[model samples]
Target: MSNTVFCRKYQKELEALPFPPLPGKQGQEIQATVSKPAWEAWQALQTRLINEKHLNMLDPESRAYLMEQMQRFLDNQETDQAEGYVPPTQA
Candidate 1:
């Protein structure tokens, strides 16, 4: 079966898996594998989110809500990274 089909059929099994089954070599090796420009772009998005969208600016309840969403996004991004979901280069 195609990877898509296989993954779909076993969606639950795939739910929390690291796609490549191996984490990238950590530390410096990880940096070496990442393109400088791509890393810069990801850094920019991270900056925007924390500087403009973080909970510190919100009222307590709204801050809690935004914090929850942001935490989920961060958690998902971590999962995707572990699963080898490289983002496309910015145009």
Candidate 2:
């Protein structure tokens, strides 16, 4: 059977990731609280943030910013948005 966690993002119990998605205490926290779907959603947003903001992972500041955003995202808290980002208009 798969592991289940009380996903903070979804506010419900759901399937957990097979392993920690990141390193350190934060990763352990996430592994115990975040679900796979929520993690995947964060991954997509992280990619967009990197691309839209031209963030360099090699820079400590950039990594820190992303980590802060990821924590907020998983906690269902408000997060910073990329400048000039506009949602696509519905067809």
Candidate 3:
């Protein structure tokens, strides 16, 4: 398989992840569509969201919230951002 894919978030061809970021159909879908940079960005955002929101992974509601956010993010839709978190601008 080619090492690149058209990133659904970016709407352009970009480097793909070496493997699925998660398990099951969701992971496979991300692997087929999301790019390395996009996924990495998501990881950072995910971290911020978790930390800022004090999310408990063991809580089903928290996990579900994160899943919903992840779907919105991957779909290039507006996601719930961390309060006071300003993304670093490209210089």
Candidate 4:
């Protein structure tokens, strides 16, 4: 059976991630609170930010920035967005 979590982002019980996305306590916290859909959306936003902002993964500062953004996103707070990204139109 799929795991379920009280999603911090959606504020409702929803499908949970199968595993922690990272190591250590932070990862465990995410698994306990963040849902699968929220994490997937964060993945897309992170990819866009990396590309649009030309973030250097090797740089400690770049990693730190992404971590901050991830926290904000998961908590339903405003987050830094990629430049020139347009949301898709609904049909």
By lDDT, the best candidate is 4
- In terms of lDDT, model 2 sits at 0.92
Which of the numbered candidates is closest to the native, going by highest TM-score?
4
Structure candidate 2, residue pairs in collision: none
- What C-alpha lDDT, on a 0 to 100 scale, does residue 54 get in candidate 2? 95
- Candidate 3 lDDT tens digits, 1-89: 65999999899999999999999998999999999999999999899999999999999999999999999998989999999888789
The TM-score of predicted model 1 comes to 0.31
lDDT of 1: 0.38
Question: What are the per-residue Cα lDDT tens digits for candidate 1 across 1-91?
Answer: 2122112212222222213222554333323333333334444554554455443554787446544543344333431122333558999
**Candidate 1 residue 19 C-alpha distance from true site, Å:** 27
Residue 60 of model 2, lDDT score = 100
In candidate 4, residue 68 scores what lDDT? 98
Candidate 2: segments with Cα more than 4 A from true spot: 83-91
Q: How does each model score on lDDT?
A: 0.38, 0.92, 0.94, 0.96
Question: Which digits, one per residue and each the tens of the lDDT, describe model 4 over residues 1-91?
Answer: 8879999999999999999999999999999999999999999999999999999999999999999999999999999999899889999
Q: Which of candidates 2 and 4 is the stronger one according to lDDT?
A: 4
Which of the predicted structures, 2 or 3, would earn the higher TM-score when compared with the native?
A: 3
- Per-model TM-score on C-alpha atoms: 0.31, 0.86, 0.89, 0.93
Off by over 4 Å in 4: 88-91
lDDT at residue 56 of model 1 (Cα atoms): 58
RMSD of each: 13.0, 2.1, 2.3, 1.4
Clashes within 3 Å, all models in order = 0, 0, 0, 0
RMSD of 1: 13.0
